[model samples]
Every structure is written in structure tokens, then in C-alpha cells.
Target: MQIKQRHIEVFDAIMAAGSISRAATQLNLSQPAVSIALANLEKFIGFKLFQRDRGFFAPTREALLLQDEMAQGLLVLERITQRVTEIRAGSTGRVRIATNGAMAINFLPSLIAAYQHKHSDVNIDILVRSSRQIADWVSTKQIDIGLIDTPVPVAGLDAKFFNLECVCVMHRDDPISAQKSIAPPDLAGRSVVAITGQHMVDRQLDTLLSAADVTVEKHISSYYFAIARNIIASGGGVAIIDPTNGKADLNDGVVWRPFSPKIYHELALIRGSNQELGKAPAGLYNLIDRSLQSLIGIGNAGDSNE
Candidate 1:
């Protein structure tokens, strides 16, 4: 038998709140309207779904039995409505993503281009922040996906392996490049520029340096590694950056060399623990992985040249 959607809503509200007055307040409907909806629903179902006693409402055994089925049906309806909204908004539905500033600048452009080519209708909104902040956003469900490096473990988030890049950074025509390889001691007592955020790159740098008993004279700190790279190029200070970002800007007179002791950065895609990744998010995440792999290949191929 066909029943109005409002009837189901009223029934669900009463079950959830366990009182007609509370359900009316929760649903933002007048108490009289709630009573009318309940009476109408009882007529439709031809059974007492709830029992009223002492000015309170309580669900009957049949209502409790039907709760799960009704909730599932409502969820399906909500999802259908969301899909329709996306279509009307000129989207197949967009996945909101946030990434570390490094990835947003160094890796996201290429990944986005490739993803758009494959799924032109799918929209993505990307925000740039530190890895730590991105991880928090994922945990809180503020965004659908996050891309960042590890060591900033966000509780209740699922992480998928993305790609790895060398942690070595470069300076343009610096005397250090002439050396076949530089030792950890070579970076000692030098001025360095670094990124700062809740998920700062400084964590890895500090770990490596502390292990080696080295200290950096932090000259400047910013969220954008690109900004730090610019400072390094202008002879302000050396910036510790990823291979992808620094390599692309080589024309600006920055030459990258491997840091001694072999530091490497790992990238991962993160989401809330209970979040169900749909077709678009999964597809876009895969596309990003491929793009990063390609970038790594190109970086590896040119390792000999540097």
C-alpha cells in the first residue's frame, strides 16, 4: 500500500524521540500537526504503531521491528536526492578533497587534469594545508579525501598508499652540487627555510637532524614549500623540499642534490574510518596515484643528470 513520505518521517521522529511533543519539536512541526500525521499513519498501516500514555509516546513492537527497514529506505531516498541535486548542479557529484600544500602545488595539477579528462562531469574542490590539518579534516569528515605524508597519524581515518618521493632539496649552483654526494654533516650549522603547519615538514627534518646530532638555523618558516624554495633561490637560505616541486623549478637556478642518510617522504590518501568511498572518490584517488607514479618515474630517470 502507498503511504506519504511525511507519514514515514513522522513515524521515524516519534520513534527517535520517544515523545510526541519532542518529535514535534525535533521535526519543527506543530504538536497538532504531529498528532494528525500519527493518526493518518495509523490509518494507513491499520495497526497501532505507537502507544500514548501519560502524555508520552512509545513505539509498539511492530514499530520497533520496522525501524531498521524504514531507516534503510530513508537513507536510499536521501542518496537518490543527493544524486539528483548533483546532476542539476552540473555535476555528477563532486568529492571535496584537501591536501598538504606540497602535494597541492607539486602533484595536484597534473592529477586533476588527468582525472578531469577521464571523468569530466565529476567536480573536485581541493584545499591546501599542512598534512596534519588535512588529516584532521578527514577525521572530522570536513572533506571526503586528504593527501599527505605520514608521521601525522590521524585517528579513525583509513590511509591508502599513494607514492614516495625523496626528501632531498636543492639550491641553484650552490657549491654543494659539485660534491658527488653530501654527508649529513654538510647541512650542519646552515640556514634553512621550512614549511610550518599542524603537519609541518619540520617533523621529519627534526627527526633526521636530531638522530644525526645536527641543528639547523631556521631562517624562515611558511606553509608553502614553494615560498621557501624561492627564498633558497634568492640566496636567502637553503630550503628542504620534495623532489617534484624543486625539480620543476630548476630553471629558477635551483639544483637539487641528495641529502646524506637517505631521507624519503611517503604520500597517502586518507578518509574517515566509516566513510564509504563512492565511484568518483575512488576513481579520482586512483588517478592521483598514477600521476604521482609517473612523476616519480620522470624524477628517477633524471637522477643521473643531477
Candidate 2:
């Protein structure tokens, strides 16, 4: 006769409980069933596994020798089950991302960290690139996903869009921070961090200043919003930047306020339309989208207060 799995469980339970009645209770079986299983197990193994002494069940020398192996086997089974659960939850995959340096700085990092906490087995990689190159990056498979501040219309890539407005990024103690929304003339003669890379946003700001007849006497030109933000934090000057990028370094004593005439930053999440996003990338995509929605709500609330 063969000793089956039920026989081993019955033996283990009896050893653990020290009696047929308690083993039955633990296994949700009747005392008679537990006794029968123990009897069958002993008969199959050709040995007496337990001994009755003064109305209590005691494990014999042979039973004691097998107990540790039984526990280890059960532990291995439990681990296998846990690994299966993690796989089903998509917690063991990899997701590679490319995005503008601004997004890499703040909200995206927070979002990625929170996701990774839940999915410790998942691997994540981030590549920082200019907004202009994000489209090509995704299309060429340089990254599984691309997050950009401006739309990129590359073939074989699809864009899911989200909107946010530019803000006046400044030191919290700056006199301009007192106002909820900064006016064009308020920045006149103030040192300003300017983007002179010929980006459309820079051109738009130039036109706005030109139309307002305002001049920023001191201008520091930079290609990266992150660099511009750092300048502002270091007491160089205030900057016009997207709220997402502007608020990325709140701990640096920088605050973002609404601009008088809003400048909308067109942001898009681009992925290869032909390729199916794997579990990790898809989950991350949904998370970033939800975060952007929340930010838009906060921006609207701020506008109401202004």
C-alpha cells in the first residue's frame, strides 16, 4: 500500500495537536476519521507512528524523524503558491520608460515608487530625454513607453493626451509668491530663467512678454526645465514652467503659482500602437493617467481660488 498525501497531512496534524480529537478539529474531520487516517498511514508505512500513553497521543521515534521533512515540504508548497499569485498579478515583469527630464524629476518618480512598492518583483528602467526626442524613442523601440510634455506625431506610435498649464515657478519667499496668479508686469525687471532653445513654448512666452511690453532685465537661458527650476531654487530668478515640472521640487522651497495668461503644456503618453503593452507597462500607464487627472483637478481648484 502507498502512503498518500492525506496520510502525511493526518500524521503531521496528529503530531502537531498531540491527540486524535484536536487533529480532527484542525483538519475539520471527525475524531474517528483522524484515527482511521493515522491507522492507515501507520499500516502503509509498516510502523507504529504514534503511541497512546495515559489518554494522550505521542509521536514515536519514526514520526519525529519525518516531521521536519514534512514541514519543509509544506513550506516549499506555500512558496510555490505565492509565486503563482505574484505572476498572476503581473508583479514580476519589467517596464522600461523614457520621458522628459521634468517628469523624471517629480510626480513620475512618486508614482513609480508607489507602484514598485506593491510590485517588488517588477523591474523598472527610466531614460531621460528631451521632449522632442520622445516620439522617436518610442517608435524606434528604445523604450517601451514615452512620456512627453509636447505631442510627438511619429508613425507607428499612438498618443494618449493629458493637459496642464504653465505656472510661475519661484522661491516660496519670493515677493511674487504672495499672489495666487502672477501677472505679466509683476515680473518686469526681475531676473528670469528663460528657455532660449527655440522651442515653441519659449516662442510663446516671448510673444506674451512682447505683447505685454514687459522686459526681464536679467535673463538666464536654459534648454532644460529642470535646470531652469534649479536656477529659481538657487535664488537666480523665477521661471515660467509647467505646474508638474515646477512642483517637482517642492522640498527645495519652490512654489508654483498660476500665470496671468495661462500657457497650456500639451503632454502625451506615447507607445507603439502595433505592439501590445505588457502587464507592467500597461499597469504603469493607467497609474500615470490617473495621476494626471488628479493634478488637473488640483489645478482647477487653484484657479478657482485665484
Candidate 3:
């Protein structure tokens, strides 16, 4: 019979303890069991492992030669078992995440930092892609999690939705910065930095402006909220942006004011419909949920000068 784990275990114990009785005690087995295992190991290997002299069991030349290799092998096995336990506990592993531009720049990095503070062993991969691409990645299991604008363009993927009130972001030096809130008329004839594509926020802003008979110059436009905030910081003009981006740029020479009449930026946290999040990803997912809930709770509280 081939040498087995138990045989090697008993052999190592006897070599360390120097006696069958002590080896049995180390392994929590009867002396006969330890002795039997050692005998079988020696028989399988065709060599005597120990030189028994009365009570003392001295390691034979063959035993000494095998000791180092066996010890190294055992160490490898122990480490493998430990790593397995860590993986099963979600204490360590790689988490692949993808997101649209909104959360990718400022929000996700901070969230990831907080998660790594608690779970230092986890490896994280972050991908910045369009919401539709993120949805596709999540559905195909290319990513463990995805943060994207909703409604999720891809069906059959599990998605959690978050609705955030869009805020008007403007240069700190602008006169509108002093206002507690910005209404559609407040933007009339203003040089407006618009979000280029007519997405949800743009459509809503357009409807409000039209209803208010407001005509704002929209010569400057961008697709990403952070980029728009950058343009606004450079005195480019005002644009409605999500609160997450607003919060990220609190100290970036731009101010966020509540925009009326309450346009909401809908977001989705997505993952494969068929997959359950592992411990590390679940921890991050829960953290994101809590952070977004905190943002929603803040409401107009996101208004800040610095």
C-alpha cells in the first residue's frame, strides 16, 4: 500500500517525541495505533525509520534523510489548510468590481479603502466602464460586482437600485453659490455646463427648464459628473450632478446646492443573477448599501461651501 497521510503523521510525531507512547499522546491515538501506523509506513517505504533501544527511539539514517522533506511537506499542507479556511471565511480573496464613471472616480475608492482597512488580506480589481458595459460584465460573471446607472440595461442580472437627488454644482465664486437651493429659473441665461448625453438628469433638467421658460446657455457639456465638477471648478458654469460626485468634490473649489424640482439620479448595484456574493464582496456590497443610504439620508444636507 502507498504511504498515507496518517502514516506520515504518526512517523513525524514519533520522530519528534522519540517514543511510540508519546507519539500516540501527541496524535491522541492509542500506542498500538501509532506503532501500527509507523510499522506500515516503514514497510511501505522498505526501510526502518527508527532504531529502538529500550525506551528511546532514535531516528535511523533513513529517517533523518526523510525528516527534512517530510517536515517541509507538512508545513506546505498546514499552510494550504490555513489558506482554505481564510477563503471559506471570506477573510481573503480577490474581488473584481466594475463601475460607471460616476462612482468609479471618488466614491468607490473611498469605499474600497474602508473595506480594506478591515480586511487587509483581500485583493481588489476595479474597472471603469460604461453602465451598459458594466451590466454586461456582471451578467457574464466577468466581474464580482458592478455599480452602474439604472434601469439596468441588461436583463437577468441581479440589481439593487438607489435613487439620489441630483444637486447643482457651481464654482465657489459664483453668485448662485450663496443660494440655499437652485431652481430652474435660477439657471436662466446662465452659462450652463450640461451633461452631454440626454440621460436621466439631463432629460429631467430639460423638462424643468422648459416648464419654467428658462433658457440657459449649454455650450459646455460632459458625460461624467466628476469631469463636469472639474469644469465648474475652473469657472466653466453650473451643472446638475449626483450627490456622490458632489460629496467627492466638497473641497474642490465647487459647491453643491439642492436642485429643484427634485430630479433623481437612479443607480444600480449589480451582480450575476445566478451567483451569490462571497464574503469579501458581500462585505463591500453591504458597505456600499450603507454609504448610499447615508447619502440619501443627508438629502439637501450635501450642500457645502468647502
Scored by TM-score, the top model is 3
* CA displacement after TM-score superposition, residue 165 of candidate 2 (Å): 1.1
User: Residue-wise lDDT of candidate 1 within 134-224, one digit each (tens)?
Assistant: 8988898888888887755678988876444444455646777676655557778888776775333466677878988988788578767
Looking at model 3, residue 1 earns an lDDT score of: 90
TM-score of 1: 0.60
| Residue 69 shift from truth in candidate 1, angstroms | 38
TM-score of candidate 3 on Cα atoms, chains taken together: 0.93
Worst 10 residues of 2 by lDDT: 297-306
lDDT at position 84, candidate 3? 91
Q: Name the better of 1 and 3 by TM-score.
A: 3
For each candidate, how many residue pairs have backbone atoms clashing (under 3 Å)? 1, 0, 0
Q: Number of the top candidate by lDDT?
A: 3
Q: Tell me each candidate's TM-score.
A: 0.60, 0.69, 0.93
Candidate 3 residue pairs that clash: none
- List candidate 2 segments past 4 Å from native: 1-84, 303-306
